[model samples]
Target chain A: MLITGIKSRPVYDRLAPMASGLRHLAIAQGSGGQPMLRLLADMTPAQRGVATVVYSSESFTGNSYEAELRAVDGIDLRLCASNVEALQVLDDLLSTAKMGTRLYLAGSEGFIGTAMQRATEYGLDRDEILREHAGSFVRRVWCAHCNAYTENVTQRIFRCPGCGLDLVVRDHYSSRLAAFQGVKADGEVPGELPEIEELDT
Target chain B: MTPTAEPTAFTTDETYTPEGAYTFRNSREGVRRLPFPFPDDEYMYSMNLEPHVPAGDGAMRAAFDIDEHYISECHHRAQMLEAMPGVHYLALPHMMEAQWDLLELIFESYARDYPEHFTLTKTGNEWHWQNRLLGIDDTFTFGDPTTLPLEPMEYATRQAQGEFVVLEERDNDLVIGAGMTTQRADYSLRFNLGMRFFEFHGPVPKLHEMGILDRALKFLLRMKPGHPVRRVNWSLTVNPRLETSVETLPEWAPDRATVDAENAGERVYLRIELQPLHRLPRSNAIVFPVRTYLVSLAELVEHAPDWAKRIHRALASLDPELVDYKGFHRYHAAAVAWLAQHDDGAPLATGYPWAEGGIQPGD
Candidate 1:
């Protein structure tokens, strides 16, 4: 709402080997699935044996790397209809995961964030988890006034379906909320709205 | 902030004595490992600022760190609160939103720091909190107190290493709006709740005259949504109990001030409190988390002879006003002599532990 292409959001890591990891879990969604396949190909045979893949079919552009992911041998792959379901599987996996387990994340900012939220639930430090951002830059926003989550938001300003108020999407992002902030567009001067522009997705 | 660098596990030495299931590891590394509040041997009140845990790790940084003694400390806190039911936890009904804010923040922090042990999830207005460390995973409507086994503040405080107080700012001044502080060094929370900033810290020596509290309040008010500022406060404690606050001052204060030479090292001890003050992002109230630790005077000397000498010098030069305020005037002479006597003829005050190649006495 206040700024554009602020690159102030979290910077992601490229697919690679992480340090001191006894076990590894690679998670992705839709187009993000491609990176998981590449990451698996980079692992040693023994490392591949211990690695697990959690994938979600959800996609903004209808992209899917399912066939390629399934073709990869040795590593285990679990499929889901949505990112939310993938997150559930990740949570269960982390509950039994130990100190030396490493996590790799690739997907939409929203999907990666949702998965990372699960990682945080298991207390994975920065050294223990690496994220590779993929898919669209389209943000998922939470209406500041009504607390309603709007998915796949591509614009800088839009009316919130929850409260019917035109909301200006803020540059800020909350990993805790797993969404961008959407505040009233014309709070200072009622009846006046900010111009609806396309976000730099 | 506690060192985010992963710590090596404790290993016992030859001279170690087992005390109440707590093994005494005679390592200077162990003593230096503790978060000592003083940067210099000479001490004075000032707005000491260090960057609070950076961003995400910062979020996980607790108002109190969970260390090896966490379970016993939690038990001690529970006992303290149970004994003094009136002073343990307090909040005005108007502070409901802030209480919920604090509880949610606690859940978020625990989930981040102990991901293997805790999980917090939200669906609609329903928030589900699972804490393996605390052994309960409950689902409840957000902000509804009746759904939990304990009050939100009490529940959060029980698992914490120390105490937490929330200060609500109004009229450009903060008030002791709510808290679950069962381990106050020497202060009365019951009498201080709702007190303005100036009055709340009135007992702190030289704070007003030196403008430490005023500057600290300004620094605290300037805290942004994500950045948190922290500092360390320290003193001498005569006991190991977590409940050695103002109410129990008489029980131990007399001994701290009047200890004889033979009892000096065994009786008096250093007490350090790692305190972080930051504004809560949602409630806009300030949260003060104090994690307190204690190491005995004799054990400290055994750990590092340089520290013993430095502490002796610091105590000798301590201001008269602060001495009486800290009740150190009671046994400063014996205390200083005991610390110096432990130096064993080494050249005193070469430098700080790190500057002097990390404390050479026990190496």
Candidate 2:
């Protein structure tokens, strides 16, 4: 009931070559590599030559496409141990990226949304960036009581480790926080709580 | 003042809101959010007014919405302010709360429309404001201006898509108390900051007689804090320029008469607007969000071929008084002819400069 097909959830894009790009950037993490492979395959050799790849191996599923990503390359491919590092390199690339540059993103909801925050900061329009959700739908939750962020949230009702409150994940998603809201689940009644179930996310 | 008493005449209130370097000190961060103000179509202007009533579940989209050009537009405004320090924002000391309210109102609307990109939260006595585009995550007391990293009005304008003006009622008439406007037809906002509503709209004919200005202000005064009212106004410009506030028109106005067949597609533009007025409950100020959209005549011909003839006829239909007021000037004949004959698309035709890559008038 907490997540009845949350309407605020972002509609992910299918990775295809945004042919208008003068330069291309393909950034991915974990199983996000699969979409990157397809994107690279769809790109022409000239496009491939102009493109740059930044891969973050931080995988919740332990899925790595590192070897395959390296194998299919004449482009500059940089490996990052964490998504944060990958995002930092992306910021640097976009800092100087020209008007015609295009961005392709594939990763978890957290990863894709956070990456979009960067693209938006750099003045990249939606037409210039393509984001495809690759992995699980586990959300990032922000506890309203404590302003603490919990990553990889799955259940609709969970105990907030940050403030020890019974948190009910709300359907409303904050792209700025890159997370869903988690408020005291039983705030209305002393002992009453919603059924603890997996989120539809 | 409860906004009930009517004033048929007025005097400029000497009491002005305080603005200083300390209040306006801005950190060089965050992207500007500019909404696409036009839809591709034949253009017309009317008193086309409507209520801010929600269509369903009390979730109605505002007349203005943030679009892709936010960051770039912010850059333009910031650079302009740097180049011309005293041209844009003007405010009275009493309008400070309205400034903060304006920030809260716009950020809350953005958080609703883009739940993913923004978060405006209130916990106990503190409010947390976060903007993903600006990379800002800040917490402050709801009414306390000092808690904010930047001044309330400046922060609000920087994040807003449209250049804004806050009109307050005093002595039975409305006055533009505060604003952060970079674009105006040929008017200097610095000199016009404290002007009455009637004086501000003096050039637009028949509005006062139609009771539009009076009715509109009453509507704004009674409008809910969260709900925003929208209106459209339009004109044809020589090029796709956003900074055409009347003071700067001389730079682009001369180019109009010279616009000929070969370059008309690149030069002539349809400057459309999406104007939204939001009421701040606490301050009783009306924040006007003016979003200007510019689409080239060439691009219009390419998409809406009938638009060429429609506008031509519309131009011809206008009365002499209106023609004299609009002042098409030297480029008038060439523009009309180009619109008439250039309907047949050329093989290598293109879009307006801004339309091609940036946020366009996709409406």
Candidate 3:
């Protein structure tokens, strides 16, 4: 009912060179390659030399800058087939990563959220990270009943793949779960559903 | 709206007896001690913070309050946890220290404030606690979770009144790391846990643009131990129901449709949350305790007419966005229509924390 104005969504930052950072780790997915390419072009030769870039080819919109990202020089690029594999790579990298490393994330909201969750687990400060939202705003929703997550949701109401209940996605977002809340749509009065509409996102 | 044909003065003789498990009976002392949220004729969002000290003779005397409803409220909380399973409580692994800090704070405060009901004695790492009011006696290692039936935060909050959320300070923000919240108005601990201060408060209207959240976060981050602060936030509920979490929305939301102008006075309740924030000494975290109090419109107009009028003005003029945000949109009109009978359009004094009589600094 009160889903019109939501401020819980994170305001993304553009990927830019942090002059003081001795090392950089840029992670992106699908359409996010454009920003990653631009960031590499903006970086000085010294900054690019010590940077490691990770990009996943998986995308919702089917837009990719994999060729342009690969042509960039001096930076080490690691490409993954999917977002899940890319996050796994990030977890392994951060486990052995040290201080003075700055993280840059550009991709879908789901990718950024998963990336930030890893960054938090690694004790990365907000100052050491930059996230730019790219691609579609298709939400990653967490079902309240089954504690399950459904990715790339574009509708206000949809059926939860986990519990099979019709779920209404609330405007409320949680960075911890890296998703919006999806509760049983007809929990109040079973079989009486609210009007269906596309999400403003 | 017409001028009052009823008495303007309040009477202490009336006793509001509980009609059900969720309903409360406010005695004369209870009515006076209530931290009524409306300090003016109208309402708007503000910092509204104050020291956690006593506001008046009958006002709250300590951080944790144990009233006549303590036993019943605790019983209600237990029932909720049993029904919901693991949905109502959450704590991250990194919040262990904060959990112990909260447990200690609750025990020490309860013992100090209400010595006749609670006591805590410590010898080395082992501690002995007795809660005569709830009939509990336990001795265990303070920091060990295996020593207790539940986690430290859950055990302490189960024995204590109200909902408690432990906010861990990290990365220049407070995160909802742990909570025992069975009595929330329309929020969920499972969804809110691990969210930054502003992230969880994102649904609130207008305050973000005014930079209130930014300013409030900076202020809270700098809060030191022993200098706690308190504020009173309010909303209207359909009944005196306490288990209003989003997890159980289906169970309670239907009550909203049952309200109308005629039954609004007896069915609607002004739900007040007495939130006190304390910076824990060891964990360097903030323990947020929300103590809820409910007074039906009928109870207020019958015993405390001044409060009834003030609440009427506040609700009648509330912003539509706020009415919706408070989850009272369906019955907002009906509640306002009923309250209009009490509001005579009389002018209230400009100061805040108005009692049955006049304004005080208590707000």
Candidate 4:
């Protein structure tokens, strides 16, 4: 894999059990279930007793380990059909989460970014969370012209559904917006655009 | 050098319009004070910072400079913000304390330096600010957002002339949490609001590997509350338009194509930002104020021939990646060629390029 040299991109870590944490919340989506299971297996019985898992079946690549995750014993599991529902479950759990809680996130870039945003809302620092990337690198882009977010974007140039302008996705990522930036493709000269190609996904 | 049409008349008392025949060039005082960044005959990225204490002539005399274009730039910023609402100003939930700190800093600076134009009075948190230039006189309780028409940071930035961003230090890293960025070079405040120092500078080439940002961040982290630091960063703009933000690329990006060697003198502009970073007393956040100064290529060649020679060499020696990153790659060749005519390739002095007869430090 070629590293794109995009420093703004969040670095993903491998999921593992932190022995120091008294409570654990593991949130996973799609292909992320494998890492979540691995993390749960690494945890001791006491850690599992205090763990809450939220798994979303949504997968861009159609990979699922929900059954395997459910088969695991001695832990609480909450399953959802979509990533949004899984996020809601995480939110509800985090609202009452204590200081000793350690969060583990596994999924695509967009999933981790949105989950990190929610974690930031409740004043969770980087030390309190560990994120592992699992799925493809389809980007969630924010259109500069119309301020609309288009998710799962794989192409460099696409028409913004919000304002209907042909936008070229810049390699720069915004952790605040939890999305990559997209500006007008032919902004310099109308109807004249640079060559289009697939993103480095 | 070829002769261009003379700029319009400008005076401090009169209303200066940005569209009014380039009034910036006509102000001899302002032209002499232009903070030309190229003291050497070459350009490169570095932590070229200095104490923000008063130094040099006009522009460097104060931490915040309110020049002849102050009113015009403020009016233009208001119009840009209104046209592009919600994109120029943003503050996260935790940045409110820093906002008030920034408001107090600007208010105190302006009132003390330009007493004729601004006055700030405080009596146990009941504050009164008066801006004679904009005819603004209002009273509000300190640290209260509901008392003011706009948020504290936005209110202060609206009256000031340039871009302002507040960076909060956390986990040994500074995060850009709040800003009023109507006049950014080519970035969006909304998108870059929560970025760390190195992350925001990620688009620029070669700065990270060279450890420039690392050193710069270290220097900023050590800045004390009372002491401030300043640096000069330059880029080229198609016109004297202040709103060169990425969101409005469709409007101003096309103007690059309209420039050729013949018209490059009039069309191309040297956009210099006087970035002054100050640590807020209360919030301990660093308030980065980017005070912009624009001089046209023609104005440089016409008024200061020494500047033309130095700029020619600086632009010619610029890294290809930097030229492309500055968004002037389209007209880079034409500009270099046009600036070549004014350069005799002579060596210049080794200090800040102050114009002849301009006041130097300790003069």
Which candidate leads the pack in DockQ? 4
Per-residue lDDT of B270 in model 3: 88
Question: What's the TM-score of every candidate structure?
Answer: 0.56, 0.51, 0.87, 0.93
* Better model by lDDT: candidate 1 vs candidate 4: 4
lDDT tens digits, residues B1-363, model 1?
Answer: 344555434231211112332333323444655655444567766676776663222222454355545555666667667767867688866777777777877777767766666798999779888866546778988778898787787777787767889898777788788888877766556545666677556545567677777787887788875677777777775545455554444354445544877788877777777777767876788888887777778877777556776677777778777776665665777788788776554444343232324333342
lDDT of 4: 0.85
For model 1, residues A102-131, the per-residue Cα lDDT tens digits are 999998898887787678667787678888
- The ten-residue window of minimal lDDT in model 2 chain B covers B22-31
What is the C-alpha DockQ of each candidate? Answer: 0.01, 0.01, 0.50, 0.55
Q: Which candidate leads in lDDT?
A: 4
Better of 2 and 4 by lDDT: 4
Instruction: Spell out the clash pairs found in candidate 1.
Output: A1-A169, A121-B115, A122-B115, A122-B116, A123-B115
* Sort order, TM-score high to low: 4, 3, 1, 2
Which candidate comes out best when scored by TM-score?
A: 4
Task: For candidate 3, give the lDDT.
Answer: 0.83
| Alpha-carbon runs more than 4 Å astray in model 3 | A19-23, A43-51, A73-76, A163-168, A184-197, B1-29, B57-59, B144-146, B342-363
Rate residue A99 of model 2 by lDDT: 81
Which pairs clash (backbone N, Cα, C closer than 3 Å) in model 3? none
Model 3 clash count equals 0
In order, the TM-score of chain B in each prediction is 0.83, 0.75, 0.90, 0.91
Q: How far does residue A99 in candidate 4 sit from its true spot (Å)?
A: 3.1
lDDT of 3 by residue, B1-363 (tens): 121222223221222222343445565556655777888877999998877875444335667865657777788788778878878888998899999999999999888776767899999989999998779999999889999998899899999888998999987899898999988877778889888888888888888988999999999999999999988899888777888887767667778888999999989988988888999999999999999887788888777777788888888889888897898888899988998998787676554453345553221
